[model samples]
Target: AAGAGAAAGAGAAAEDVPEVERESPAKAPVARRRRTVLLAGTAVVAAVAAAALVVNLVPDKGHNDRSGKQSVGTAASESVDSSPDASEPSGAKGRSASPSASRSGSPTASAPASVSASRSREAAAAQGGDGSADGATAPAVAVNPYKWEDPCSQHYLIDQNPEQVPPPPAEPDARGWVNALGGVAGGQQMLALTVQGTGKATVVLEALHVRVVEKSAPLAWNDFEMGVGCGGGVETTSFGVDLDAGRPSLSPKAGQRDFPYKVSESDPEVFYVFADARTHNVSWYLELDWSSGDRHGAVRLDDKGKPFRTSGNVGRPAYTYPLGDTEWGRNESYPDIPG
Candidate 1:
């Protein structure tokens, strides 16, 4: 009866407490879970705010690295490429030292001086400049139209005959032999000159001029006893220059046409150049003027950068090596062969 009365009293006290604050009659532990959802929501909001703050303050390391690498790469490229504002670097000395090699290696400088200068001017004009302030020339284009034959390949008239003609040696040896003989070319030199374009663009050959470097008496070192066959063929166009003249110039044959000819890779032109020196030993070269599009230039032609030399063999000493004879014999008539 005492336990029942105590229970009744506790139940009457529970009725005074708020329903939400009252524990269930089953004795479920509800206080621990009451605010669990609200706490979880507050924790999530705090984590998101911290993440946003970090994102706004820190920069991407990878992006910065790439930008730095790009700047270095740009500088490297600029060093390799030619700049229109500066003088040539030491690297360019190789090109300037060997004009002949450069002439053959690149198309822009391969042409005559006038044509080369003209092309350079036109290129500068196109870019709104007049070349570099330091006087550096323009870069070379890949295409070059000048096709030169070996100077030693062509047959030359040497007044001196070989002691014993054997099979010819290499071209270098042949050139050396001519030099050893003190030969300035006897009779005439027949040079086979060919011209074409690098691409489909046509090049116009305006004129061929002669420049006289030196004139003197016929060389006595070339005085020899015998003469061999030294003849060359002719083409549609041929020019003859009289080295003995006061001012030597190119003259066409009676039927040959003058210059202002056009040429391309598919349609090349072959010209036979005949230089005669009957009285004076002359050192000279040929100047060729040409143009293509807005580019014009002139080029000098010679025997491996040296002027073409020729001398008249009017009254020089002569010898004869008859076909059947084993030793050289003196021919009574020098500079003349008896038929």
Candidate 2:
């Protein structure tokens, strides 16, 4: 079986920051992180070449968080000067910046969720939910549900807080919650989420989508199976998610492809989806997820006849989550994600 793999990339920030009325005080955790990175990352300083360069390099924190800036398509251009020779290392292996400056996490596209603002909490509740179809194997899904279970909270922006923007509901339509995002090419599953703040948010999806396409004796498209619905605390502004089944049977394995795992030449399957938040006109994509397994997800069925999901890089960065802390991975846990 192949582990799951998903990729989420923040495209670019918008041209201008839209002003808002509220002034969120700096939170303790955010302050700590900011201070730590500020003092530690000397690379940020070396990137500034001249007076004109200095003006654009700093990220604006007053109007929105870093997460908001990252989503804006042009924010990075506004901050850093583009030169053919400017490059920096992210301090991670297999990751380096080039003169043109493309940022990525290890060979994958998972960046961190750059949300550093205030946040509130609510339990994961079912909204806009309908009973599953009897004998329907498709996973349940929630389309554009309320960001918060507490419908009356200040951050719950569906209807209660008209002026506020809520974290993206899992699906775009605000209708049903499926078990997972449907499959695409490369044996991956994916869904789409819209993040709208100042468009400055930095969404780092750590998983990739895997799909199974057959050229000969193609299986009926109807035979495709998926699991959709939101139950975990994984966060993104509504994500395009999918699962992969690696191996010939229901057994598990590591990484994308192995020699024994080769498919028939006539029907070689591509098993990865790169979903990015950057606004672009490219054919490839970068997605975000909560586990590295999301990155290793497989499309081919394993020996046990069970499908497998790869881990995405978007999960908590630490090796482990805080024990007994249910809020640890909550989507609303991030300040930008909404309560």
Best by lDDT: 1
Encode model 2's per-residue lDDT on 1-339: one tens digit a residue. Answer: 122222211111221222221223346668888999987676556665455576667666684555654455344443343433223444433332232235422232121122111100011012221112111111111112212211111111111121132222332332232122231121222322232221112222223333333122211111111111324432322223222222111111233332222222122223322222111111222322221111111112221222322222222211111334322232333323211
C-alpha RMSD (angstroms) for model 2 = 36.7
Tens digit of lDDT per residue, candidate 1, span 1-339?
999999999998887675746557434545445567678888999999999999966878766555665556555545444333245466654443234233333555434443565566667567676444322232122211111123322333354555643333344365565665545566566666776655555768788888999999876543433333334445457778888999888888758988888876577787877787777888888877766665556667776557878777665554444456666555554444221
Worst 10 contiguous positions by lDDT, candidate 2: 116-125
Q: What value does the lDDT take at residue 272 in candidate 1?
A: 75
Task: Tell me how far the alpha carbon of residue 231 in candidate 1 is from the true structure, in angstroms, after superposition.
Answer: 7.6
